[model samples]
Target: MNPLIQGLATIILGVGGCIGYFYASNLLLDKVLYPAKGPNIASNIRRANIIRPWLFIFPALLVLTVYLAYPVVGSAYRSLFNRSGDEFIALGNYVALLESPEFRRSFLNNALWAIFVPVMSVTAGLIAAQLSDTLKWGNIAKSLIFMPMAISFVGASLIWKFVYAVDSDIGLINAVLAGLFGAGPIDVIQIPFWNNFFLMFILVWIQTGFAMVILSAALRGIPEETIEAAILDGANPFQIFFRIKMPQIFSTIVVVWTTITVASLKIFDIVYAMTGGNFGTEILPSYMMSFMFRDDGRATSVALVIMIIVLPVMISNIRQAQKELR
Candidate 1:
């Protein structure tokens, strides 16, 4: 059979099956319960009628169990073993990770990311959003600021790679520094500790737009009446921003902080593209990938570490979303 024809047949069958199931289930329910409605009903019959829909839900639940829940459990189990997939090493992978210097540096880098990226990005975004809000050309400013977010992390890394290029003429940073300070071209990625900061700046550049858009929306949601009242009370511009606007959007601040924090935790592309996790720039995800050919134990440990690091922030975000929904 032709692939397109097969695909169309499969889709039609799926639609037909779903329609048949609904039609049959409704018919069964009507015959068994709906036609027998009475002034008084037994509790068991009422319960059974209520639970009839659950029969239809069972297939979806099973699918989720297989696809989502099982894989998580299976991955956790696989992490307990070594690369051979035979020996049960228990927490040996984790123990090795804790003692490894490379893993330690990766952990430290991730911690820096969780702290620095969110703070810097959110701060830059907040400042940009505030400034843009007041400007007549605010839309143009926002478009330019947001342009970076449209670029892939790898693409952004390549763009910055030229900016930090080693040759004075080839790299923008080197050219500017050479002209202004009479200094030689610098290989920014090769610099220790600080190179991580440089790599993180790319992420900050990309994520700042996301932070700004969310924050700008929140800023717009602020009531005109509140600002007027603050003005009537003789509040200065700084006072209105700090005392009134900031407080109203405090929850949004938390949301943006955690959102960036989560992205930072899983960051891989910029570091991988610019440095290949070299020069002490490895974070958890890239470090985990390094073990793909060699030590499965260490790699799994890194994966678990990433999971553990992200779990708390994920939970907090969930709770915040729930609160917002309420």
Candidate 2:
């Protein structure tokens, strides 16, 4: 079958299958199990209503089990083995990971990312949101700022590679430096401890727009009465923004912070694309990929560690979102 035709057929079959299932289930409830024609019609309707919700929820439950639950469980089980999965060495992979210097470096880089990316992105976003709202061409400015978000992480990393290239002729920063001061070309991504920050800036550049859009809506949602009262009380612009505005939208800030924190924790593409986990830029996901051909046990063990770290931050984001809804 042609690929496009196959896709269309799959869509049609999926829709048709869902319609058929619902129709058949309801028909069975009405005609066979709970007939409306009987003396117990009211009780039968009530019973059918109770079962109907579960029927609707069953598909979603199955998908969650297959996609989400199964992967976590499978990874956990796979981690309790030798490199080739021949013999059982429960928790040995994890113990090795704890002691490995490379793993420690990756963990430290990830920790720095978790702390630095969210904070910088949100701060830059807040500044952009505040400053842009006052300009006539603010939407245009926002569009340009957000343009990076549309680029894939690998594409963005590749683009930035040119800017950070070792050649002064090709790299933007080196060209400026060589033009002005006759300085030598520097590989920005190769500086050991500080190179982490240079890579993190890529994520920040991509995520800043996301943070801006969310925080912009939150800023717009702030009650005008409070701003008016603050102004009447002779609060400075800084005071109103920090004391009044920030307090009002602190929860939204936290939600944005946690959302970016989750992204930073799972960061892989930029590091992998730019440095291939070399020069001390190996975050957890990139580090995990380093074991792809060597061992399943070590790879899965690293993945489980990532899941454990992300779970709490994800739950906190969910809870904060729920609080927003309330």
Best by TM-score: 2
lDDT of 2 at 193: 91
Q: How well does candidate 1 score on lDDT at residue 323?
A: 92
Q: For candidate 2, list the clashing residue pairs, or say none.
A: none
Q: Give lDDT tens digits, candidate 2, residues 1-326.
A: 89999999999999999888878988898789988778998999899889988878787889999999899999999999989999999899999999999999999999999999999999999999998888999999888888898999999998899999989888998999999999988889988799999999999999999999889889999999999999999999999999999999998898899889999988799999989999988999999999977999999999999999988986876786799799
Report model 2's TM-score to 2 decimal places: 0.93
| Residue 260 displacement (Å), model 2 | 0.3
Listed in order, each prediction's TM-score against the native is 0.83, 0.93
lDDT of each: 0.87, 0.92
Q: 36-152 in candidate 1: lDDT tens per residue?
A: 456544664576578677867966888899987786677688889987879999988888888889889989989999999999999999999999999999989999999998999
| Total colliding residue pairs, candidate 1 | 0
lDDT of 2 at 267: 74
